[model samples]
Target chain A: MNNLAVDLPGLQLKNPIMPASGCFGFGREYSEFYDLSKLGAIMMKAATGSERFGNATPRVAETASGMLNAIGLQNPGVESIIETEVSYLANYELPIIANIAGSSIEEYEKVAAAFNETDHVHALELNISCPNVKEGGIQFGTDPKMAANVTERVKKASNLPVYVKLSPNVSDIVAMATAVEAAGADGLSMINTLTGMQIHLPSKRPLLANQTGGLSGAAIKPVAIRMIYEVKQQVSIPIIGMGGITTSEDVLEFLLAGASAVAVGTANFQNPFICPELIDALPHTLKKYGFNTVQDAIGKGITV
Target chain B: MKKETMRIKSTKRIALDTVEMVLENNYMSQTAVPGQFLHLLVSGHTLRRPISIADVNKTEHTITILFKMLGSGTHDLASYQVGMTIDALGPSGNGFQLHNDNQSTILLIGGGIGVPPLYYLGKTLAQLDMHIISVLGFQTSKSVFYEEKFRALGETYIVTDDGSYGDQGFVTDVLHSVESFDRYYSCGPVPMLQAVTASLKDKPGYISLEERMGCGVGACFACVIPTDDAGGYKKICKDGPVFDAQEVSL
Candidate 1:
């Protein structure tokens, strides 16, 4: 009860836990397990300009410590979300971050503009990093100018807070992160899925229906943490970190990497009660580790 | 968003990649009819496994599920033995519906592992005073099972592609022999579903489709199929795993 709140720019979330998009589809399922209102916020599945059928079969392929998905952003389109899912999500009474994607910058603006009219939607998390689809994936994320352009467009068009979702498949995230920040992005979330592949060795063909996919799960934790630390140094904006978060211990790691908040992803598939358990375990770990607040633990171990 | 229709009472590994699990919960059992499926939360898998219930004993407080190890999750379930626990969320998707009071001939056709769910459906229909014609197809005789059990339900026929069993071809040939029946029920591969749809275009039939679903509920829009009956796409998880013959576009 002694102040566990984590603020992200203009928005105030009661806690630092939010479900990553695609992992938590509007919190309807999670509601069956626990009171979703207890969490800080929710990231609805990545929305797009039109309804997507997603990739073909075997969209998800498991690796050593993670899984890759080429789901191709399957959704009912943005207008449907505003017309359907948003009302149910708004019931959570916390910030509702809309994770959106598109084939072009104009499409991003269209998706963002739809949410701008809704008072309950706290922010627009532009997913420039998703590796699943054929259009505007790494194309918008890897290049500083492209990243800046999309961020600028959404910021210019959206009345809500804009958080640019960064991709990990880049060589220097610092450049991309810096570019988005300068483009008027309110906050930043990193790093979206890492592009990887799984080979069906017997057939000697790529396992995923789409040859390459975005890798996520416990495997990418280290790489994600490293990205958070590097970006924390270059950008002063709030950082919402997500990649392979499974437990409160992992949450503590993200906090220590200079993330203002953290998101729970792939772990939901492994355990439906992951968030509740982590919520129960988090504060205790913070005090035991000599930190008064979860925020104080942010970037505690990193020198750079 | 399928709820935990039941909870694990006992779980055991009976084979290399096979798990013999029993779940006990009435929310699922009381309304749990045959040919319906249950999605399993396999510990290490990225998602749940949509397994057809092998058998369910409501009075004894048990539902049986057999999971074949295909990947990490099933491999994890395969490692468990007696008294182990797992989560179950289902009795999901529409099961086969038979006219309870009608005295009619019932044709039950299934293929390979698809034969499991029909065992229960055939058993349920046998309760009524009716004639049941069962035709099962498998790749080989070794893979064929429950023939005697299904025979107890009514008349049973077996077919294997290798000719190591009853008929030396697809089971559809034997099923076609019936020519006409009051009703037909089937569950199997897409081609088999397509075949059933094509063959029974002029007859009364019910077909269940199995699609890789996301939420196992109507929400995700992941398991959508063209509806010949409804016009728009219908969600297989909620609207059906079972569909009215004329409703599904092959």
Candidate 2:
């Protein structure tokens, strides 16, 4: 009953449980199970200007507690997303955050400028963390300068809130977080998939065609929480946190780490009921901890 | 699995591997056709595992699933009880098409785990009045399966790489003696599939491929197959897990 509303800087959500890009697929298939309108919002898969074939075979390599994926950011292009996925989800009663990544700065700005007025999209998640692709994806996240430049251009070009999604496969995440924030990023979605791998061993070869992939699941929770906590100390903008979050307690950990909102990424692959369970678990857990709202949990245990 | 088309039914555990628990369920003993599959919701696993219909029985739910314990979800699924109930969505997918009424005899070859779909195929061929010859291949005798059941269907042969069970060599070696069949169908590992395609390049055949799929529908394009065209890519789930050998590159 308490206010679940979250101020995502330039955007507002009734709640903070949006689907991470890639896992939810613009929210249609999952809708077959339950009404998607009940959730906060849907983040579209990463898109570029042209259709990409993605990586080679065996994109997913399952590890003991997590999964590694080298999806190569294979998308149907920005125009296609606008026509197919965005058009459909925009009318679903929630803000659609169009996630985009490109090989260049111009490509980022181009997508931002166009989607700024397209459909019901209220925000743009500039993805600079996808490691599987060849172009401007990981390059932007690895360097603070490129990350800031991309953020600045997208921010200037976009009328909608620009949320820069950061990669965890870096030496210092706070550097990337601070650079993007200073470059006018309105919000931050921390921790895209961590680069990892698995092999058949017997085959004397790598498990995935790409050899390595981004790892996401319950195993990465500890690392994700630590990074979110570190970034929370440096950036004032809201931090979107996700890593192996299969239960509500996981959501609380992100909040306590100073995440303004939390996202359910790899867990969706584990179970479709994760979102509803999270929504219900949050209130009960909040009350259990003697808090009335999730905001009460943010930074509660963080030193900063 | 209804009274009209089905008669025999039973659920049995045939093998337990480090990777998965292979559970077999039987359905539609009378009317169950070849190239068809069933759905099984192994409890503890979030969604149902759509396994190829290994074999059939009319009186009970007929199917078999070899589940690999890759993560917590599938790992939990490996522990499904023998009698526990679970949700399912099947007999889905466009299974391999088998028409014995055709003029020429048919050749069915399968390797590794790809033999699941061939089980029903063999049974259906037995029901028809045609010369059905089969080559069931595996890595070794321990993992080798369905040779006896296949023998019950028609002229069956076996080839194992380890030479533990039958002929020492690949299934392609057994395929060498096949004079001619009007059609051929197979499912197996990628290398085995490539070998099949290469060996039968002069002949016509249909193949079923396995890829890491996101949405089992065309929407995600996660299961795309690279084609001869520079700009063309076919979706395995939608375009097919089954495709004309001539159409697929490998």
Give the interface RMSD of candidate 1: 3.7
Best by DockQ: 1
Estimate, for each residue in B1-250, the C-alpha lDDT of model 1 and write its tens digit: 3456455667765433456677777667766788788877666565667788778787976777766666666677666665656576677777888787556888888977677787777777777776788988877766666778888887788888899888888767786677468888887788887877787788888887777655564544456676644335677877888888888676
Error of 2 at A128 (Å): 0.9
The TM-scores, one per candidate, come to 0.91, 0.85
Model 1 lDDT tens row, A1-304: 5545787765687878888888777787678778888888888898888777776655666677777777778788898888888988777767899998999999999999988988778898989988878888668988999999999999888888898999998888899999999999889988899989889887899987789988888989999999999989888898999999988888888999999888888877656677778777888878877887877887786794
The pairs that clash in candidate 1 are A256-A299
Off by over 4 Å in 1: A201-204, B1-31, B69-76, B98-101, B128-130, B211-239, B245-250
Q: Could you give the TM-score of chain B for each candidate, in order?
A: 0.88, 0.80
Q: In lDDT terms, which candidate is top?
A: 1
In model 1 chain B, which range of ten residues has the least summed lDDT?
Answer: B213-222
Residue B7 of model 2: what lDDT?
18
Q: What is the TM-score, restricted to chain A, for candidate 2?
A: 0.97
